[model samples]
Target: MKNDRAPFPRREPSQVTGQRARPQEVLGLFATVITVVVLAVMILAPVARAATSSFVFVGRGNGHGVGMSQWGAWYAAREESKTFAEILAFYYPGTTLQAVKDPDTVLKVRISSTPWKSNTTSFSQVDLKPTVASGTLRKYASNSDSDFTTQTISAGVLVRVQNSGGKVRVTVDDTSVGTFARVDLVPGGSGASEGRNNVQLKTTGGTTVDYREYWGTMRVQPGDDSGELWVYNFVALEKYVRSIAEVDYDWATIGGAAYAPEAVKAQAVASRTYAVAKDGATLADNWADQCYRGYSFEAKYPGIAQAAAATAGQILTYQGEPVTAFFSGHSGGYTTVSAWSGDTALPYLVAKPDPWSLGAPPASMHSQGPGWNWTYTISADNLSKKVNGSLKDTSGRTVNVGRISSVDIVSRDTSDATSHAKTLRLTGAEGTATVSVLSFRSLIGTSNLPSTLILSVNGDVGTGGTDDPGSGGDPGTGGDPGGSGGGPLLPGEFYDVGAGHLYHDQISRVVVAELMGGYEDGLFKPEGTVTRAQFAKIAVSLHNLMNAGDKILVVNVTTKPFDDVAIDSKTTGDTSDWIAAAKKAGLISGTSSSSFSPFVEIQRDQMATMIC
Candidate 1:
């Protein structure tokens, strides 16, 4: 009989006298117990194992990756012996290289304006005088409300203008000439019409010189706000473009070698094209439009001026119109669509492979541009801090989110022959959110994670120690699997929530309330000052988003509420509609009874009160 229970009971020992069991029965019991123990171990081992908790981010590129890559152009020109036209053609495919009809056309750039700084009730005086080396100077004023009249003035004559109690006072040669809201200065021979004018004045050395020799016209006007003066320079387009190129591009020797002249020419054309595409009503003298340092910049960088002259009148045109030429410091290994860079899609502004970025000699050779290939390491704690901020939507609405845990690249676009992450998945302790790759880059710090072209993400979730290094390969040829011909990803549809800001909480709250939105470049710019026009747009958007009332009609309005709010007014544009609507709703009042002071800068407290 089988004795199951001896020392270790396997079976009930046949209900016999257990003390008298044979050694064989005890052995049988031991064997059966060992078998059961082995089976138990096999079933429980897998359940006790550990899980993976880390990830890393491997990426490439440095900018929005749209249009031309400065480094790539340099490489093509230096290594491949390509011309500027060839480089432009490669980057802006299907676009025509054309020449401007009037290269000497003037650009109205607001260089120094105090209006955006104050809206107080104080007053100030601004003195403007035109001087020429050999030509006579003249003052042009609006004869009728719709026509201009001219009056000859002596060269080097002082014209004093003052803004007091929301009215303008004008005086010439210390005598009261007239008081007008606006005035223009022209050469003696030039007509009163708004056009290019010249002046000549004697210098300290007693030498007469042309006004263009010193730069161009200097127009002074009443400040949009109190105690301020708005000064502008009506500069020739070529000169303006040259000034920008000198400041933005590095003309210094690199690795004991000079930058390719073709690259400089390419930049000149691109910059000129961008300027031409703008409406030219009021271009900023800085990067808001493009860096313009006046005659000082042109005098400093003679090489930049030469490049501009070489590409004089040349611009990239699409279907008979100037195309919006976009460029950046480096493309990493690929270029992206204009839409990826907060711009609308165009036939010419498409992404393409950039082999020059990879084929060029290493950074040690001094051929590679800055940010060509980069790396960044971020810890989990820091990442959490970055994600718990607010991002504004396209509709000017803000969305505040919580701490971030994991980041995943979901969808990609390869329509431009290069792979770039279009959509990003951000997981937080509270919930998960999805955003455009561009928006994510902005929130994460554009310098930290420069571009949307990613390779991998590796690390422990929510616990830091992630490495984001640029990938290595031939930038021109490598293709990411399943990363081409994808549908366009709209950036305005997503929000950029992150940390490292002073007004993070307030901005996040306002964005969530749908009262304000981020710039197209994907920055909330919490510390940036807002103009009256900008505030008007925000107010109107807020009222509409919150469905405040039907009192304000933002639709087609034949009449303007303020003199400065008219369609043809200096500060007029899309904001005019919003200003009109807000005025009709009694949500906003003018600086004076008739003057809206649309260009004045609004303080933070003022914005808050207006919103409330």
Candidate 2:
């Protein structure tokens, strides 16, 4: 109270009426400021860097970064605002987009249907021999005997119906079991068909044996029962197959003789030649018939020798029986062409020769980075009527090559990002060419696969014993494991509302493209836990389906009953978009607390809730 009016009474080293600052206080304030600055740098630096990395730098853009950047032309076009045709010409350079003058002249082939039959015997074929029980039988004394009794012994044969088709199907007995294409006989067990029976036939003379009839169908070959013949251009197919076989055989002989007895190599070549040269039915005589039927090498003309060689390589077994050398006329394009060819069974004509690699193919333009240039040449040897080619640049300019094949391009830019879009376009050439490009972006390419071959056995092993051929043929659409052709789809294939983040249309389109119009379920149930990892896998599979090599996203949002979810957590970057997209689509929802509970055992009801 005395000091209330006198600040100087207790103030020590104070300016006016204020108290002096402590040294630690001054240091603490300075430290706090420094810590915030450091933290900001730590957090913001990465984010800033990532943002800078996503951009695609611009450059001249006819699909040929070197030859004609169409976008550059388009830039020129926009400056002049050219016609679509003009735009095409600006990038294409020498090519012309002509109308199909005689489309019908070309032959088209498609697999109408694939039918399968079981080659294995059925349950009815087992030989069940009759055998009397060996146990002692007690016969009672008759007539005067007061007590009489008879002891009868019983024995059973074992039989089991093994559906060895390697596929799950509801059997005739209405039980689901894995069906194998080839079912072997196990014998002596209770099965769908009873092959054993204990019974005595009474005849006027004495006791007689009883016969039992067991019934079942034999296993058939795939694509046979339905009589769904896979049609192809008879002449063209024969030519292709023969050629592949011939090439394969010749290569094997030449390549192997260097390591084996000369006789063995010569024999292989002779056998292969004879097989292609034969004229009738058996391998010994079928060459002429094959040629007449458009399947032999000689019948295919300039294609004959090549076809025979190729066919021999494919069907003729080497000493080691390996696939022959896969040559690519095109250098940079071999890996791409081979991969696609292997799948479709398409033939590959190498598109690149050595030394001329001027740059990267137009397809690789978009992926190029700063300070690089590329040039490429494609060939016509690999082109087929159904195929079309394109040279695409990162700038969104695609030089449509139609069916013609030779091309070349060059490109350059100051900045690496800006350098990528330069390229060249070539058409009408084939056999091999070179492409060179300077770039930081990885190049990507694709090719088509060759067709498959199906061999069939003669039909009609007599009638009556066979199952009835219904309105649909044997092994009809109904029997297909992939699902019946031209019928409604399955539930699992359907789009469940609210349960998935994907739109029905988007999923349907993908399904149509992939599984080809068999996906069924239509409704979606939001506000439920999505379970059944199989279902999750399928849901997330769309990312790969759409973009091929890109990353995917996956997430879970359900109630809190499950202890797996952590608050404010996220999946890694690669799949984040898919997971987030799913969330945004109303396909997923959190548990009871409204927060996505990522780790919880999904219940059946929850599955239904999510997939509804």
Candidate 3:
């Protein structure tokens, strides 16, 4: 059955075995969509299944299918005797390798972060731009000059930092050291057993408080609202590269055992370059960024340190600047971009063939097995739970599309030879949804699906209740895209939008609510971008919609906070009062103190922040 996707979980066919519904009836929110939609495929943010016992998904590769494929590189190095520079040249085409101008750059690698107890969404923090959410951000600790307190710490003292009474407190030897905004722990005394890089860091999560060593200063910083702290390892660039243990160093020993140091060296360069690229941004010390194990990982395989030193300062540069070198565990056969990062701006990060990942690995390749290919079978009931549990709508709420019926591979990425599956359509009793393979993988564990590079699917699902249920379905809620039942009818001159139009119902809702209106020509340009002034009026209307008696008055005022606004504030379409009122309500802002830029089209982020 054909499914026109509406933000991930699309509504079931609008007709159910015993009822009819709308897209909002299924997913409960309005959002722009991702992924391709075909007769067999679609995309989503939510799901569930009921008709079948289980569907077995067999897939290949691991990690996001973008940038370098580790197995591909390893095979090239081990079999083709490709040099590190040559390997890098092939994987990161159109990039020049340059020596480091500064080898000691410090990277703020977040080694540990506290969990959000109430957050059950499937998407990880890495999916968002700003990784750390700041809570009541306060001024510096009264006794310290900076938000992070470290210089005054006693030499070799064991420190435990935790949130206390909304203030972060540091304790040493079971005695309260002080309450501050942040704490820096220096593992000294016997704790510094593995030299500078091998100092162990004990965490509170484990029952016995297990520790991991790092090669730099460990800073514990408090988060916004939670009692949790984000621990970072402020390590130097070279040392940080040496500390990465993404893959074992033993891959250097091939069948011939002829100095094949290229693979590990290439990894060092890639890892270093990625860190340098993300120098200012928050980075997790895991695969979410790069697997940085610090001193402990370094100690386990000393060869990695040698490899890092050998490729010291070497980085992949595109147009003279270091590129955000992304690398994955394996590519089924080719690498493609994940939608989270736009591909247009990053020309180097595109889909390309990688014939190497398909071949057998060398005996010395370690855990990278041909056995990496995997199959996982999950029951329909569990599939529903897992999908419904994590697939969050754009509003960041979970909408259950009761018990899934059928799943179809709708589209594939035609950019490269791998032609990885791009979208999946899921049908359920409550509704139907189509979601990107990337997002769907999150609904089901990545460990289960591995990558979107599906070799084949070997299972079946019952037919969804697409057949019309007895009687017309229940009316949709506020989220209904169809503006039916109780709502003011649009003027007859509004000929553009009719019952069959895509946004006919949605347009009806806003028009009926009186938040917006048709143009002079009786046309509602639903697809057009909204201007700042236009949005201002909408914002004011929104405030008034919620506050019936107390509406924001739009009056004529020559003197206002902004000088660029027209003198006659209340003239029809003048926008001055709307701007003033929205700004007064703290729902909008101008380009600057004097300029409203009222004619400028509003950006997406601006709308998000104002709505938030």
Write the residue-wise lDDT of candidate 2 on 184-229 in tens digits. 1212333343222221212212322233211111111122322111
**Superior candidate under TM-score, 1 versus 3:** 3
Choose 2 or 3, whichever is better by TM-score. 3
- Model 3: lowest-lDDT 10 consecutive positions: 1-10
Q: Which stretches of candidate 1 lie over 4 Å from their true place?
A: 1-60, 102-104, 112-162, 167-179, 183-214, 246-256, 279-281, 338-344, 359-371, 376-382, 392-401, 415-418, 454-612
lDDT values for all models: 0.53, 0.24, 0.54
Best by TM-score: 3
> TM-scores across all candidates?
0.53, 0.16, 0.54
Q: Write the residue-wise lDDT of candidate 1 on 509-537 in tens digits.
A: 44444456665423343323456776677
Candidate 2 deviant stretches above 4 angstroms: 1-297, 300-302, 306-564, 569-597, 600-605
After superposing candidate 3, which stretches have Cα over 4 Å from the reference? Answer: 1-54, 113-179, 185-206, 223-227, 252-260, 343-345, 360-371, 379-405, 415-417, 427-432, 459-612
lDDT of prediction 2: 0.24
Candidate 3, residues 464-500: lDDT per residue as tens digits? 2121111111111101112221123234212234333
Among all windows of ten consecutive residues in candidate 2, which has the lowest summed lDDT?
1-10
Sort by TM-score, best first: what order? 3, 1, 2
What C-alpha RMSD separates each model from the true structure? 29.9, 34.1, 26.8
Model 3: residue 329 alpha-carbon error in angstroms: 0.8
